[model samples]
Target: MIFILIVTLLIYAGLVFYVAWSGYRGIGIKGNRWFLIAYSIIMLFLSVSFILARFGSGSTLLAVIGNYWLALFSLSLMILPLVHLIMLILRLTSLHREKTRVAAARIAFVVLVAALAYGSYMAYTPKVNTYTIDIDKSYPEDLNVVMFSDTHFGYLSGKKHAERLVKEVNELEPDLIIIPGDIIDDDLEIVEKKQIFNILGGLEARLGVYGSLGNHDKFRGELSELITAIETANIEILYDETVTIEGGLALIGRKDYSEGERLATEQLTSQLDQSLPIILLDHQPYEYDEAEQAGVDLVVSGHTHRGQVMPGNLITNRLFENDWGYLKKGQLHTIVSSGYGFWGPPIRIGTQSEIVQIHINFNN
Candidate 1:
């Protein structure tokens, strides 16, 4: 973990320095010492603020600023590259280098700001994505399963966010609610102090709200405290357990992959009645073949966040077989949500926060 953090920091520092150099060149470095100094100070401050946040510095404002800056930095990484390419083409064509460079710099800055603003808006506005699937097994009626994952409820997602989510899910009138993981941010103090868990209790679902633990969900204080908090919210936390809902529909929730030595999917489903349809909830989207082999009708997950930012999804797409949407693998179906909240930065570029409402139609 320490090694990965160091490598990530190195890569981030390298990219930031490259972007800074490109910006300086784009603006034709002459008399730009002050600009360079200012930019350097801002980047340094943001970097330090982010590090402080990781170490529990406890300044919400600093953390928010740092995260927003991280989003802007990521946006710059994508937008500035194209600007540099344009500048290169203009320079090669001998089209007044100084003027082209300055224009490119101005355009890049404007584009970066616009992208950041748009992404921030996308992050806050939660969209409901509805998917209807036909189950090949017998059941009484259609099951309205509403799910949202990665609601890291701490500094970024506070009481208001929780309330909003509750209102939205209640409005959906779901028969069952499944939270695939990451109910809390890495800390439990803020969530408990603010009574965010109680606010989550407002969520009204007929079959009750159920959740599976994710990597982030396990990062905080006592596991018992987290479970108690979730239970207090009238939500059941399923840890490698199976429960048959009222209609004989079996719901299996697995411990997150980060939890170490979890029950195998096949082992979990070995003695289950397969004719009634089995739905499995696993936080991270991995090992699809195991779920398929285990006769899991549908698997829901959310750890990928579909990269949570632009080009990040491209990486996630390559990493997971089905990163964002629904995929049919033989007899099993999997749906991975982009998630309802942000992780590091409260920004969503090339992606939007979503609540997945799946309609399961059972054919007898």
Candidate 2:
């Protein structure tokens, strides 16, 4: 935990320094003096808030003040990229004092604003992708599986977002819905009070909805509550459990890798009938090799969130074997979803939210 805190502090410090340098470059040293002082104060308050929030004492008056300070801090954070872009434009245009330079800066600013707005809209506007998988079985001929993950329901996403998610799932008319993990943020109680479960309850699937506990869900001490809430909403929580679908297909769910439990890959595979196709629901995508070796036919997961921001996706993709798309390991198919919600900033710089609808068909 101390290691995590230290790493987090280092990252935050790096961001502060980057912002300071960007502001200084954009506005000039003299003009940026006040901005630097204000940003420094915000950073200090933000650091304190981070520490307090960790201990769950971030709701008092001081915490409230800290929260506002962080909000302002975030506002400034949103402006940092713009500042850098402006500075770059200035540097390029300063060499040539042409009227075209002024026009170019205006155009660049307008383009950046439009891009940001469009990206935000895309992040909020969820997309549902339909897919088909062939698993020879004898029961339900036409089965629809709805998969959405990484909702991270807290400050950024709440009841409204849940409602939209429920609405989207209902539209798909799925036989079952699967939420791999990261459905809630560190603060699960906040989402519960927001009646997120009520919204989720409105979603209808033929068999039921099944989900696994994400790292964040376990961290918040709300795993049981979240499971109860979702179950009350008629969705089933399948933590370290297996259920047979109507067509004899096995659906096994494992808790997030970070959760204190055995990997469950071999155990889950050992319990399943090899003849029947097995679908494994895991939160992290890197476990594909294990699932493949265990003879799992398909694996579905979504913790990467496609970085939830730019450049991060590049890094995440490089780290994970199958980061944000479909990969076939021999006969096994693995699908890693970018997920359906934002994590921290609420602003998704690159990736958009998604709902994956999978259809399993029997070739034989």
Candidate 3:
């Protein structure tokens, strides 16, 4: 773990320096000493944040400040490319000479900053995306399932955020609510924060609230507190286990993807009654094939966050067959959310923050 942290810090520091270098090049170094000084100061803060955040600052205030530093650094990375693009366009069109090209670069910087600000606001405001599916078999009436993922509670959101989530889910009148994974941030201390457990416990679902662990949930390697928090919030944690709700629907929760076969999908479903509709909550969206072949009807996931930001989304799009939103295959269906909250950057660009409302109707 120490080695990984060291490597991460080095990479982050490199990124910070590169962003500063990009700004230097874009703005031209000829008479920009003040600009360079300002950039250097910013880089210093970002570097400090990298160390403090990665190495573990015991102070909550430092953590929050570090998040803002990371956000600014992230915005700079996006702005660099845009600045370059603007410079190139201006030079290509010859609409502006050298002076004009420089001005256009600044314009690009403003545009990206404005976009980052708007994206940050949207990151906190999760929208509800509803889906309705019909099963060919007969059963009790319809089941309203509200599923969300990637809350990253401590990192980007906390009590007030969870409170809003609870209110929103309740308003949807969901029969069941499942947080596929990533209910916690990378920090385990979030479980102790009054706001988190307090508001989460207030969540209302007709059947109940259920959760599966995500990579973030195990960040500290101690699950007891988080588990206790979940239980306190009236949420059942499906740790590589299955539960039947209302004696009709089967919900299976798989641990985070990295756990590597904590419970093989085949073994997990071999004894199940295939006639009943099964909902698999696999954190990483990886077990879809196993679920589909095992007679699992649907899979809900949220690890990808649909890339959360751009080019990143482009990579996630290629990584997962269904990186975000919904995908259907024969009798099997999958819905992957972009995530309710964000991680690292605290902004959502090229994707939406969402809560999923899936209305499942049984065919008689």
TM-scores for candidates 1 onward, in order: 0.91, 0.81, 0.88
Model 1: lowest-lDDT 10 consecutive positions: 23-32
Q: What order do you get sorting by lDDT, best first?
A: 1, 3, 2
TM-score of 3: 0.88
Which is the leading candidate under TM-score? 1
List the global CA lDDT of all models: 0.86, 0.74, 0.81
**1-364, model 3: which lDDT tens digit per residue?**
9999899879977887887776666576667778778878866876687458757754666677777777777777877766667666767774747677567667767876797788788898889999988776556878889999989888458777888898998999888999899887777665465468777888888889998999878656567767877678788999999988885788888878887758877766765777888888988988577778888888999999888877788899899999988888878889999999888777888787899999888885
lDDT for each residue of candidate 2 in 72-99, tens digit (9 for 90 to 100): 3454566556645665677765465444
Say which candidate scores most in lDDT. Answer: 1
lDDT of 1 at 234: 90
**What's model 2's lDDT at 322?**
84
Candidate 1 lDDT, 253-298, residue by residue in tens = 9999987899999988985887779999999999899999888999
Error of 2 at 101 (Å): 12
Residue 243 alpha-carbon offset, candidate 1, angstroms: 1.2
**Candidate 1 clashing pairs?**
none
Each model's total of backbone clashes? 0, 2, 0
